[model samples]
Structure formats: C-alpha cells, structure tokens
Target chain A: MVAHETLSRRSVGSDLRAMGAVAGKELTIARRYPSFLIAVLVWPVLLPLAYILGAKALAGPHGGSLPAFEAATGTTDYVGFIVIGTLLWGWLNMTLWDVGFFIRNEQMRGTLESNWLCPVPRGALLIGATLTKLALSLLFLVISIVEFRLLLGVNLLQGNLALTLLIIALIIPSIYGLGIAFASLVIRFKEANAMVFLVRGVFMIFAGMTFPIAVLPGWMQAVAMALPLTYAIAAMRAVVLNGAGLADIRGDLLALVAFGVALPIVGYLAFGHMARRARRHGDLGQY
Target chain B: MTATLSAPSWRSNLRAMTAIARKDFIQYLRYPMNAVFNVLQPLIWLTPVYFLGKTFASPVGNVGFAGYSGTTDYMSFILIGTVLANFITTVFWGMGYSLKTEMDAGVLESNWAAPVPRPVFLVGRTLASITITAAMSVVMLILGAWLFGFHVSGNVLAALGVAVPMLIALYGFGFAFAALVLLMRDANTMIDVSNFLVTLLSGSQFPVTVLPTLVLLVSLALPLTYGFDAVRGLLLGTNTLLPIPVEVLLLIVFMVVMVWVGLVVFRRVERRCRVLGTLNMH
Candidate 1:
C-alpha cells in the first residue's frame, strides 16, 4: 500500500515536470523569434494610441471630456476608458490565438502526431501553453499601462486596484476554456488562420470590447450577455472607472465564476471527443 | 558572350501581365469562402467604430463630428474612410508581399527566367490585388447604403475623378514599397507595422486636424491624407483641407515621382539580389 502511494505521487510529480518542460520550450521558441517578441512589446502601445488620438480628436482642443461622451459612458475619462478597453481586448486576442491555435500550429509544423503520442495528458500540454501566454500577456499589459501613464498622461491609479485585479484574474480561466473549445473546432476543420480571424472578429463585435454593450442593438446585447468577456469588461470598468467594490459587482462576479467552472469541463469533453473522432478517421496528421 | 536580347515589346509585356493577372484571379476564386469573408471583413471592423461614434454623437445637429470633420453624417464619413483603408492595406500587403511570397514558394527563380520584364510581372500582381480590393470596396459601400442609409450627396463623377488619380498615386507608392520589400528581404513585420501606422495616421475614423501638432505634421506627409480628404470632399460633401485642384495636382506629382523612384530602386535591388544569390533565402 505504501509503495502504491509512492508510485502515485511520483506520477503526479512527473506530470508536472512534463508540463513545465512544455512551457519552457515555448519560451525558448519565443526568444529565438525576435520579430514576434518585438511585435508583442510594441503593438499594445500603438493600437491603443490610435484610439486615444481619436478620443482627443472627438473631444476637440480641451481633452476627452465631451458632454456627449460623458452622457453615454458616464465618465469624462475617455482616454482611460479607451486605454483599458484596448488593453483588455489585446489580452483576449493574445490568449485566444496562443491557446486556441496551439494545436493547429503543431499540425502545420508537422509535430502534432508526435505530441499526441507523448505520455503527458493533452490537457496538461494545453495548460502549459496557456500559462506561458498568460504570463507574456500580463507583462505586455503592464508595459502598456506604464507607457500610457508616462507618454499619454493617463492616470492609472484612479480606482479600486484590488477589485480590478480580481476581475482580471477571474476572467482568465473562462478565456482559457473558450480557447480550448476553439482549438477543438480548429482540429476538426484543419484550417487555423482564417478560422482564428473569423472567431476573433466575432468576439470583437459581440464582446463589445471597444464600447459599452448598451450601445449595441438589442439582439447583439443579448449575444454579448452570453459571453464571459462581456461581464468581465463591465465589472472591470465599474471597478477601475466607477470605483465600485466587490459588493457592487457581485452579480457579474458570480456569473464569471459560473462560466469559469463550466466552460473548462465542456471544453475538455469536446476536445476529447473530437480527438477520438479524428483518430478513428485516421486524419490526425492530415494537415 | 552574345549580345543581350532587346527588351520585350510593349504588346508582349501587356499580354504577359494580363496572363498573370488572370491566373491570380482564378486562384483567388478557388476559395469562395475567402471571397465571402472579404466582403464581410470591412463591415465587421466598421461595427465598433459605428457604435463608438454613436456613443459620442451630439443630440443636436452636426455638432460633434461635423464640428471637426465638416460632416454631420458620421456613418458616411467612416464608411468612406473604411473603403480607402481597404485600398491602402491591399496595396501594402498584396503588392509588397507578392515577390516575397514567390520567393518563399521557390518560384522566384523560374519567374525571373521568363521573358517578361520584372516591372510588368509586379504590375500584373498589383493590378489583380487592386481589382479584388475595389470589389470589396463596392460591396462595403452597397452594404452601407442599404443598411445604414449612406447616400452619396456630392457629385458621383467628381468623386470618381478624385478617386482615379488617388488610386494611381497609391499604386505608385505601392510599387516603391514593393521594391523596398525586395531590398529588406523581410515582409511580415514591415507590412504589419506600416499597415497599422498608416491606418492610424490616415484619419480613417476621425479628423486629422484633431491630432497633436506633431502627429498632424506626419499625417500631412502621407499620400493617403490627400486622397482621403479629396474622396470624402467629393463623395460626402465634406470640406477638404486644400482645394480639389491642388489635391489632384499633388497626387499626380506623387504618382510620377514615386513610380520613377520605384523603377530605379527595383532595378538596383534586382542586380544586388542576383549578385548576392539570396533571392530565395526567405
């Protein structure tokens, strides 16, 4: 019985080591590709600056304190609103692409079959990739916030920082689950790039990443409500812009927790079923 | 040791270019889904901009956007900007990357051996891209007209007049950019960065005058600024930064200068690539 217990513990340790190895491999690859690293560091600044410039243009010479903007968004801090929206949208995009398209990337590089043959669980492999992407995305986010504060004079310390961090941390699990489910579709379809773009585009529209969902048409608002990102963004704005606390955002927090737990189970089952189907059809390495 | 053959006849060059364009069109059509997506892509991108405008729209008449852009109808203003952006992106990505794509596919050497001149081949690929982008633009305009009531209030012929010259200038700039891509031996990063920067600087979603003085100066240097102002002025009855005649003349000058510079640079790069034997390295 003691030997059996030790064997189980050893297996758990080995699984963790394999997961760490996978994540380390991804980091090494990213280091080798300097252009991609540069893009990661630079795009967050440029993309948000476009919107910030637009806000300035709309607000005229005074700043982003247009009365109409204040009426619609309930905040005169249009620059901060846009900066936060763009940053979160960028994070969502990186997560979706990095995690959802991981398998598709392997297939394109002719390594999918070998990866599937490995002893480590597929879920562990995906988790490692997601963790690496999460770390990189967080780093980029921090850098972008610093750049905005220094160059654009955006005030980053205005609201409930603890609550904002809590919302962000809670939303990540649901994003991972959604990404995993997206990966299953990619594995089934055998085309990653176009599908990734289409999915990302749909998310951009439905999630209301750049604007409030209330501005969306009624049907679109319904669709937005179903997305975990919708609640997360709303909660984030409440905390960061409105200075709302945990009690104020309890509903959204509960909804996010529900989605965070449910989606991973659904994603894992869907991926397992798709994998089996592909294996049966003898098309795992077709791409 | 024999004397080099004379340049191919103009008629032969035209025929070869047409053949290449036709081949590309056929290849493009094979993926019907791509065509459908292309038609929808602009609309997808426009959705958020539309909402953002509405969020800040003045309750009164033309006070918010018209105060800055000289047009109260933000939808038409943004739609035209989106169409122009599509054209610029096609020029940058489709034309600039054509040669690099050929090299990556291991066909650049074989294509170089063909009787056609390099300029004619490059122009053929660019023309194909222009045709596709123009179709997408038309689809976007029609969708806007049907769904959002975006009508052309100004002279249609006048708008076409402005657009034609601007397109020529844009193509000239694209040729220069294609030559630069050949010299650099990298396309992805350059194309992505330039595309983002140009889209941001061109005032596709707002008035350029609202930008900071420094950024406005940079915008003035971009050809798209003139094209955007002229096209919007003609199509949407908006005010142009400069008179129509001045804008048209500047566009023509840009076209002539850029095309000439493109040819010289492309020739130099061609010789360099031949000497270095790195045409297919990427």
Candidate 2:
C-alpha cells in the first residue's frame, strides 16, 4: 500500500509539472509583449467608439437614440450585443491566432525541433497551452465586459446567465480543438499568419460575432451556420436580445456539444498527421 | 522572380504578361485557405444589413439614391464597396506587405541576390494578390445579388469603367500603407488608422452629404469615397442620395497620383531598410 501510494504521487507530480511548464511558456511569451495586449484591446475599443459615435450622431432622428438602439437590441441594454460579440471574439481571435499559430511561430523562431524533441505528449502541450490562453481569455473577457459595462452600460437581456457561461465553457475546449486543426494546416503550409489574418477578417464578417448571421448572403449564411461560432453567437444573441427559452436554443446547445465531441478527435488526428509530415520535411524548425 | 521581356512578338509579350500573372498566382496558391478568406473579408462587412432591418433600411429610402443604405435590397451595392475593399486590401496586405515581410524573412534577400529584376518579380506577386481579390469580388457580387437584390442600373460596363480606375486608386492607397509598414518598424497604427479611415470615408453606411462639412470634404478627397460613389451611381444613381460624380472624380485623381507617389515612397523605404541592415529583424 505504501509503495502504490508513492507511485501514484509521483505520477501526479509529473502531470502537474507538464501542465505547469506548458502554461508557463505560453504566459511568458504573451505577457512579455505589448503587442499581444494591444491586439486584444483593438476590437473592443474600436467597436464601442464607432458605435457610440455613430449612435450619437444618428440620434434616431427623434427620441433618445441610445435607448432606441438599446430597445432595438431586444435587451433594453444595447451593450449585450457588442459585449458578447467582442468578448467571445476576443477569445476566438486570440485562440485561433495566438494559440493556434503556436507551431508556426515556434517553427519561425527556430524552436520547433527542440519543442518536439521533448518527451511530453502533444496532447499535454496543447491542453496546457490552451488552458493558459483560456485563462488569459477569461481575464480579457472580464475586462472587456466589465469595462464596457462601466463605460457603456450593459443591456443584460435576461438574468441567471450561468447556463450561458456553461455553454461557453464547454465550447471553449472544442473551439481550441478546432483551432488546432487549423494549426495543423498552418504547420504544414508555412503560411499560418496569412490564414490567421484572413480568418480574423472573416470572423468579423460571417461568424455572427460582429453581425447577425441571418443578414449574410444565402451562401454566406449557410457557411455561418456551419461554423462553431454561429451557434454560440446565435444563442448569445437569442438569450440576450430575444430572452429566448432553452427550448428555443436547443439546437445551438446541441451543435456546441457536437463540436466538442467531434473536433477533438478529428483535430488531434490532424495535428498528429501534420506533425509527422512537418518532421519528414525537416521544416518543423523552419518557422 | 522577374526576367526582362525583350521578346519582340505580340504572342511572346502576351506570354510574358501571362507568365508574370501566373507567377503571382502561384505564390497565392501556397495558401488557398487564407487567399479565399482575404477576398471574403469585405463581403463579411455587410452583416449589419440583416438585423434591425426595419430601422437601417431607410438609408436608401429613395430608389434613385446614389448613397449607401443598410435597408435597401441593394445588398449588392454594399457588396460592391466590400469587394473593392477586399481587392485593394489583398493587393496591399497579401502583396506589398507580405513582400516586405518576406524580405525581412530573408526570402526577399535571397530573391534579390538572385538575378531577378526587382520590379518584375514584385509585380508578379502583386498580380497574384489582385487575382484573388478579383475572384473574391466576383463571388461577392454573385452571392450578394442573390441574397439582397443588388443590381447595376444604367450600364454594367460604365460601372466597370468607374470601378477599374477607383480600384486602381484604392491599390495606390494600399501601396502607400505598405510603404509605411516598410518604413515604420511597426505600422499596426496604420492598419488601425486605415481600417476605419477607408470604410468611413467611402460613405459605406451613409452619404457623405450627411457628414459634417469638414468630414464631407475629407471624404471627397478619398478615392474610397469615389469607389462607393461610382458604385452607387452606376447601380443606384448618385442623386438618389448625394452627388455621385464628386466621389468618382476624387477617387480617379487619388488613384493616379497615389500610384506614382506610392512607388516613390515604397521604393525609398525599401532602399533605406536594405541599407540599414535592420530589414531582417522585428
């Protein structure tokens, strides 16, 4: 019994060390740079500025324009729309661009071969990195929502928002998983930055994060429907804007679950495949 | 990489042009996924049209309005602006900016060290970015027209004629932005500044006439405004909202002057960066 306990304790220690190392590396890189912080704040600041000014300038041609827009938002709070959009996107953009491009950036920095040479499993590395990003994401998420609320008053369409938070929590892992799939492609192609930028732009357009997916062209609408963010954004808008019941958002919840289940397996498989291909090409360190 | 075309026959010259274009295209092919989205960026900007449709749709309450309206079935009109933006942005971001970035990556150094004529080689990359933008714009046109009922009113060719020059002007601005990136060790500010500047100036959401006098004047000075104005005029009619030709001419002049200015400014940055040996470090 004593020997068994000792072995188990040692195993736990190793796991903790691995997780700590992965998180430590990611935090150091992101925190050391001002660009990362700058990138995080850009969208949130710009949108509020643009919308506030435009809303102010337009003035509804009559009554309190801000309130009217707020009412139009279905939440008496105009901010729910912008807040949800900005914060969720803040996570998504950071994950896809920052965390997802890890392999590519590492390759560029000439650390790929060394990183891969370690005994740690790729799964552990990715999870650890993703957790760090998620934490940072949560930090900004709070800052953006709180800051925006303080500065611009929240619309808070409905109360008891825990389930919404839960849905976001479940989806976060899957979203990073999906990003890993994209990262695998990035690792293979050496053009991750361009892809990251393009994805960021498209997110601004079709992800339903910035604007409603219903407004997209039919094809674009179809594409949006297929994306993971569509469900999250739509549910968010529905709950906030429409005071939607769970039944009304059953589809979105189900979709998020589907994404969680399917993406990790497929994305991990893809990552493994890409890692092998990159190794064969000796470009794992090419970054 | 560029090779001088001294081949004197029309067939050969055509081949050279095709080759240059092809080389540019091949570079874009290196990342099909990214290229696809680069063009899609502008189309994505049209999302504000769907919701609050009841309120936003009044921008084009006039059937003949040359201005942008979120409410009109003229989704294609907005798409025109977006497509033009995509074209212009990709040319700069994908072509000029990426080239300078590649130069720092030592790819440019290697290419320069090779015997390729600098202009010809770089132009091929530009052409590639242009191709992606063109395809994206066309896709946006079709998709936007299908969903929102957009049209080109008087003459499609006239719209084309207007758009070509305006697009040229837009690219000129892109080159200038790229030049700044080359010069500024970091021009994220330029991206932010230009991000709102082009969209706002183009009267993308409302007529310039609605802007403050100074704001209206500034919009008139930008080619982006003209791109949108010419688009509105061709498809919707300028008088429907505001004067269209004012924007069209401004864009034309801006494009012409910017092209020459961009070449000069960008080349100077290239020379300075190369000479300083700081071109390769972030």
Candidate 3:
C-alpha cells in the first residue's frame, strides 16, 4: 500500500483539478450565451452614464463634476467614483449572489442531484464557480470602463493606486462569504431565484451602488454600512476620491479583512449544513 | 348549418368562466405555503424602504435637482417608488413565471383542452394573481400611510377610480408578458428583461425629470409610467390633475388591446402544445 503522505498529496491534486473543472464549466456557459455575458457590462456602464449626464444637468456651470463627486466620497472625475464603485460591486455580485445560486439554478434545471454525485469536495466546486464568476465580472468592469471613457469623455485620476487595488481585492472573499451563506438558504428554501432579485434589490438601495448609502434614512444607513459592499465601496472611494492611502480607509480596510477571514468560514459551515440537511431530507433531488 | 356555430353563447360561457375561476382558486388553496410566500414577496419590501428616510437626515433639499426633487418628505417619495414599482414589477414577471409554472404542472395544457373559451380560462388563472395584487396593494398602502407617514392629497374616490382601470391595464400589460412566456422558454431571462426594462421605465432611483430623453420617451410608452406619474401627481402635489384624463384614456385603450392580444397568443400556444406530446405532464 502507498504511504499516507502520498495518498494525501494525490487527494489535494485531484481537488485542484476538480475546482478547475467547475470553473471551466461556468466559462463555457458564459461563452455560449454572449448576450447574458454582455449585459453584465451594461450594468457598470449605466452607472457612469447616469453620473456624467445627471451631473452635467445639475452641477454648477464650468465647475468640474470631479470635485463635487470627490467631496462626497473623495474621488475626482466620473470614471473614478463610478468605476471603482461599479467594479467592487461587480466583484460583490460575482462572489456572493452569482456563484451562491448556481446550485439553485442547477436544481431548477433538474441537474443538482446528478452533479452532486461527481467526485470532488463541495468546497472546491464552489470556489471554482466563484473564480469563474469573479473573472467574468472583472471582464465586465474593464469593458464598461473602456466604453464609458470613449463614449462619455470620462477619465480616471491616479491616487493611492496600490491601496485601491488592495481594497478591491479584499472585497472578493467577504462577498463570496455572504453569497455562499445565502446560497445555503436558497438550497434549503427552494426560492433562490426569487430571493436573488429581492435580496439584490434591497442591497442596491443600501449598498451605495446607485446613490450614497448615506442617503438612506438613519437606521437604514447603519444597516447599509454593515454589508461587505458598503465596506468595499467606502475603501474604493477613499483611494479614488479622497486620494487616501490604505491608512485612510482603516475602518473599511479592517472590515474587508474581517470579511475575508470570517465570512468564508461561517459561509462554509452554513453551506455544508444546508447541503447535508437537504440530502438527508431527500429534497435534494426533488427540485 | 344547424346553428352549429351559433357564436358561442354568453350564458354557457359565463357559467364556464365561473367554474374555471373556482377551480383556479382551489388550485391556489391547495398550495397554501406558496400562497403565503407569494403574498410576502411584496410585503417584505414595505418596511425597509418606507421607513428608511431618516438616513438622509431629512432629505438633501436638492435630492433630484431644481430644488423641487428633495424633500423633508423623501420617505414618501421612496415609498411611492417602491410601492408602485413593487405593484407593476410583480405583474410582468409574475404572469410570465405563473405561465411557466402552469406549463410545468400540465395545468396550462389541461385548461387549454377544456371546453371553456380560452379568454375566460386564461382570465380565471390570472384572477388569483390579480386578486393577490389588489389585496397586497391595499395592505401595503395602508401600512405605508400609517408607517411611512405618506399622506395622499388626492380625492380618495378619484384615486380609486384611477387605480381601478390602472390595475387592469397594468395586469393587461403583465398578461402580454405572460403570453410571450410560452414563446420564450426561459422564464428567468424574461423576468430579467422585464425587471430591468421596468426599472428603467419606472425611474425608481430618481425623478423622471432626471431620465435621459430616450428613457423618458420609453417610460411614457410603458403603462406603469402613466400610473407612477398620475399617482405622483396626486401624492406629491406637484403636477396638475388635468392630465389625469389623458393617462386614464390611454390606460383603458392599452388594457383592451393587450387582453385581446394575450388571448389570441395564448390560444395559439395551446393549440401548438396540443399538437406536440409535451402538452401533458405525464
């Protein structure tokens, strides 16, 4: 018989391949349906377009839109404020909502049970799916930025570039945690599709995506700030708008760090719990 | 020709309509859990948004530009947006999703095979959804009035008159979506398109004045915009009530046309499905 260490190494190698397979499946699906893939780009594009035109109509004559947007969140120019917000949002959307509900969608297609029988740890499959979603959303962010810069005459200002990147990078796992945590609920509840829109609708109002979460009524603002999207947004705004270093976004940066560590652990426990419960109940195949 | 085609008598058709409606109600009751969950879908939104105006610290005084948009009463503004959009949004995707549900259950085809007039039968299925919308709206409106502190200045009777045909028209537009559901197999895509399009049309994020010209034009083209505009005019005390006549007239015409078209399209699908073996769930 082979030694225990060799067996462990073999399992790890297989797990890596399994994760890649899941990511590959998501990419192929997106490629086949280019329309859906393209629409993700449209959402980010709309965010900037709303700002440029609305600001032009509303802002003081010959005084920059950049300064005004910067005063609110610390960025100058429409591109920085809108792009960073949209990019982090795109990341949050990918990691949390997008990958989380893949199982629910699979259930609807009557494919979940069969997919469950495949040889791989559940964690690998989920992580792989999250990887693919984040990849596509990042692609969306790039296309939208380039398109807006060309069509809307917007440009970005450089400031704390590395910190901005760090803030955005920290946003992923926190969001992935939230997404997986909720996806667990979807697996249990059988209403993930409906819940996705409803939950996202609530998040949009609170996340400072369209308008500042500060615009929310007081108690609601507190709730909004608690979400990972809020932290991601605040941190991005700090770098892009306030010319802030990571030091300036200590609170937001700290939040993201905690989210990165805590949320995934909590999410994994919940996801595994839900999956096991469903399997035991025999409802895993019922959908 | 032996009066064989005596043009479907109204008496029997009316009777069949009631029977079909009764059966649909029974179907709704048979799934009590779904019914409760369905009602909760809109109710869940009433709280988070309607009372969340305190976040803005009593509005920005220039929330939508021209100093006319912001208000100490921004909660009411958001309330109207969420409530009206909640009402209109449900109609489109619900009709479509319900159609998909019916098709999956074989109920759509089974009802299609019945001797009842297709319009009556389809209307019967939609009746539960329509009733649900009406009931949910009343509950939310009462809750909003009480909780969100939004007061309506419109004559209550006048608002009711406006809302009556308006719901019919909105539901009619919803049925148009429902009709197309069979033509497009992916209910999720249909839901996404309608949700996205209606969100643009409703101007929920900002005032309609802030919308780009193209989107503004499309908003006018949609039935929901007229409802939102009319409702806002009454609730917000900004625009005049004289334009209410035009909105009412357009809404009525749209209702008739959509209902007629929905019937026609739905019947065609029923026949198409009958030709294929997929009509039944077996």
Candidate 4:
C-alpha cells in the first residue's frame, strides 16, 4: 500500500523543478543563436516603420490630412499610437510562434517523446517554455522602448510608467493563454504555419494594429471588440499617448481582466484534453 | 568500362529545369490548404492598409494622398505595388527559404550532388512558385477591385514590360541571398526582415517622397524603387521619381549589374561552403 501510494503521488515541488529545468534549457538554446539579438533590436523599429511612413504620405507633404487622422484616432501622434499597438501585437505574435510551436519543435527534434515519458506533469514542460518566452518578451520590451525613442523619436516612457507596467502584467495571461490553446490545436491539426497565419491574420485585421477600431466597418468593429488586443492597444494608447489616468481606462482594464481570467482557464482545459488524447492514442510522437 | 556522358547544352539544361520545376509543383500541390492561403494571405495583409486609407479620407477621395502621389486612388497604388511585391516574395522564398527548407529536410547536399549546374537548380526552384504567384496575383487583383475598388487605368502590357527587368534583377538578388542562407543555416528572421525592409523601402505601401531624407536616399538607391514607381506611375498615373524612360533604363542597367554580381558571389560562397564541408551541417 505504501509503495503504490508513493508511485502514484508526485509533489508540486517536483513539477516546479521540472519547469525551471526546461526553462533553463530553452534559454541556453536561445543563446546559442546570436543573430536573434539582431532581430530583437531590429523588429521594433522596422515593424512600425512602413505604417508610419504610409501615414506620413497620407498626411501629405504639408500635413493636410492630419485633421482626418487626428479626428479618427483622437491624437495627432500617429507614431505613438501605431508603435504601441504593433509592440503588443508583436509580443503576442512571438508568443504564438515560440510557445505555441514548442511541442511541435520538440517532436521534430525527437526529444518530446522521451520528455513525455518522464514522471513530471506534461503541462510543466509547456509552462517551462512559456516562462522562457516571458523572459525574452520582457527583454524585447525594454529594447523596443530604447530603440523607438532613439530611432523614431517617440517616447513610450512618457506615460504613467506604473500603469504601463500594470497593463503589461494584465495582458500576459491572455497572450500566453491563447498561446497554450494554440499549441494544443497545432498538435491536433499538424499544420503549424497555416494555423499561425490564420490566427495572427485574424488579430492583424481585427485588432486595429495600424488603425483605430473606430475606422473599421461595423461588423469588423464588432470583431475587434471581441479581441483582447483591441482593449490592450486602446488602453496602452490611452495611457501612453493621451496621459490618461486609471479612471480614463477603467473600461479597458476591466475587459483585459476578464480576458486574463477566462483565457487561461480555457487554455488549461484545452491543453489537458490534448495531452490525454495524444497519450491515449500514442500520437504524441506522430507530429 | 568507359562511360560517355552527354555534353552539357541548352537543351539538357532546359530538361533539368523542367524536371526540377515539376517536382516542386507536385510537392506544392500536395498541400491544398497552403495553396489556398497563398491567395488569401496577401488579401489578409492588405485589409489593414485598406482601412488605414479609409481612416485618412477627407470626403474628397484621399486628397492628402493625392498631394503626395498625384492621385487619390490609394488602393490602386497599393494594389499595383502588391502585385509587383508578390513576384519579389516569390523570388526570395524560392531561392532563400527553399534552400533552408531543403537543409532542414536533410536533402540539400544530396540534391546539390546532381550533375546539373547549381544556378540552374536555383532558377528551376523558382519556376513553379513564379507561375503560382502570377496566377494568384491576378486573382488577388480581381478580389482587390471587387473589395477595395482597385482599378488600373494604364496599359497592362506596358506595366508588364517594366516589371520584367525588375523580376530578373530579383533573381540575381535571390542568388546572393540563397548563398547567405547557405552560410547562416537559419533563414526565417533574416528572410522576414529583409523581405519586409526591401518592399517597404521600395515604396510598396506609400510614396517614397514622404520618407525622411536619409531613408528616401536609401529608397532611391534600390532598383526596386524605380520598378515600383514606374509601374504605379503607368497604372495609376501617380507621380514617378524620374522620367519613365529613365527609370526603365536604370532597371535594365541594374538587371545586368545585379545578375553578374549575384552569380559571382554565389559561386564563391558555395565553393567556400564545400571546402568547409558545411553544406549538410544544418
């Protein structure tokens, strides 16, 4: 009876250790590729550049269309508005590709099956990768702020810094939650790039990355409201660009909090179902 | 035993290229969803740009944009750019990303060991994708016209004439990039960033005149900028940076220079990789 109990029961402490080990392993592998550092520096400036230039041309040589843009977005600083939106969207995009494809990459490397054979909870492996992604995302954010300020002459730090941090913290759960759910779907569908294009393309069109949601058609606006990034971008723009306090962004905050709570639960349920199905069917190695 | 091999000729080269293109086309058709997405993906990217133009409308049909590019038909300008940009993407992917894909599949070295000339192999890889891109560009343009009201008022054959040199020049650029992929072993970030930068700097989404002074200089230096500008000028009657004839002259000159430089660089780098025995390492 004692031996059976010991075999069946594993402590939370062991899972935590496994998570840390996986995170460290991922971090080490990431460091092996130094060129990624170039991406970290280059993307923040380059990603928003074309849109900013497009806006410049649209504003005309003498800034004639500034009135229309200012009226649509409520700020003449299209650069700030675009930068904030793309930054958050870029974070979500990276998380989707990095954490969502983690399992598939492991499978391709032939490490996933062996890792699944271990006694640790399979969720811990994913969570461990998520932790590394979070760390890298944080690094990306810091670099983005410096690069944007220097290159584009936009100040992302001019906002209420504390509120900006809080907004980032709140958006984390939704981002990773969607990523977890996405990872499971990729496992089931076995088409990683197609799935990524479909999912990210939805956000790109609906989330007002380069334009205000108010500019979208009525149905598209409805879809934008349903996405967490719409609120996150709106809230970040409000605080960072408009200098709005907590009160000005209360609605966006509440919406983000709701998504933050709901998405993770949905993600966990989806991941749990996928893990069981893969193990039962012995399909964990198939992809 | 003596084995006599057929002397290499244009006919044999053509046969080799046809075989390579056929294999790639077969593999591409095996994934129907990917083929479908190739048509949809550009439209997906264009949606925001479409809405972005809508946001800037002043009830006078993009009068502000007209001040920059000489026309308020912003979607038309963008759609033309998109059509030209599609060929650029095909060349980049066909030469660079395909090499990376072959490397990951552990077949690149074996494929290279064939008796065919290496440059022929690279060009053959692009043939299927180029055909597909052209077909999809037509469908995308039709969808753009229906959805965003994009229409071309210029001579289609003339626009194609300007585009031919630009596409050939891109082949030269792709060869150099493929050599880089051979060296780097990782292609995603490099390809993504470079592709985005090239298209953006070439004024795919907006007029290059609006760029800051330094960036505009960079834009003018890229041969693709003239390619985009001349095509848009012809199709939409938008402003061109130079006289149309001069731009065409520049593109022809660029095509000659880039192809020569590209072939030289690729041969040198590929030889270096073979010496280092790193062709199959990735």
> Which candidate should be chosen as best, given lDDT against the real structure?
4
DockQ for the candidates, in order:
0.52, 0.12, 0.12, 0.79
Per-residue lDDT tens digits of candidate 3, residues A1-287? 74563423558888888788889999998789766754675566654453343443233234323344444543335445555655565556555567767878788899878877776677788888888887876776567657656765544335676786687678767777888888888888776656665666566657765445654678878888777788887666666666778567898888889879998898899989988898788888665
| B140-235 per-residue lDDT for model 4 (tens digits) | 989999999989889879989999999999999999999999899888888988898999999999999988799889999999999999999888
State TM-scores per candidate: 0.94, 0.71, 0.77, 0.96
Q: Which pairs of residues collide in model 4? A: none
Considering every candidate listed, which one attains the maximal DockQ?
A: 4
User: CA lDDT, every prediction?
Assistant: 0.79, 0.63, 0.63, 0.90
Interface RMSD, model 4, angstroms: 1.0
Q: Rank the candidates by TM-score, best first.
A: 4, 1, 3, 2
The positional error of residue B205 in candidate 2, measured at the CA in angstroms, is: 5.3
Model 4: lDDT of residue A224:
95
**Clashes within 3 Å, all models in order:** 0, 9, 11, 0
- Reported per model, the fraction of native interface contacts reproduced equals 0.47, 0.12, 0.02, 0.80
DockQ, structure candidate 3: 0.12
Quality class of the docking in candidate 1, CAPRI style: medium
Ranked by TM-score, the better of candidates 1 and 4 is 4
Colliding residue pairs in candidate 2: A77-A155, A107-A287, A108-A287, B57-B71, B64-B240, B65-B240, B65-B241, B169-B255, B226-B247
Model 2 ranges off by over 4 Å = A1-10, A47-79, A103-121, A146-287, B1-22, B29-71, B105-124, B185-197, B205-221, B238-242, B260-264, B267-282
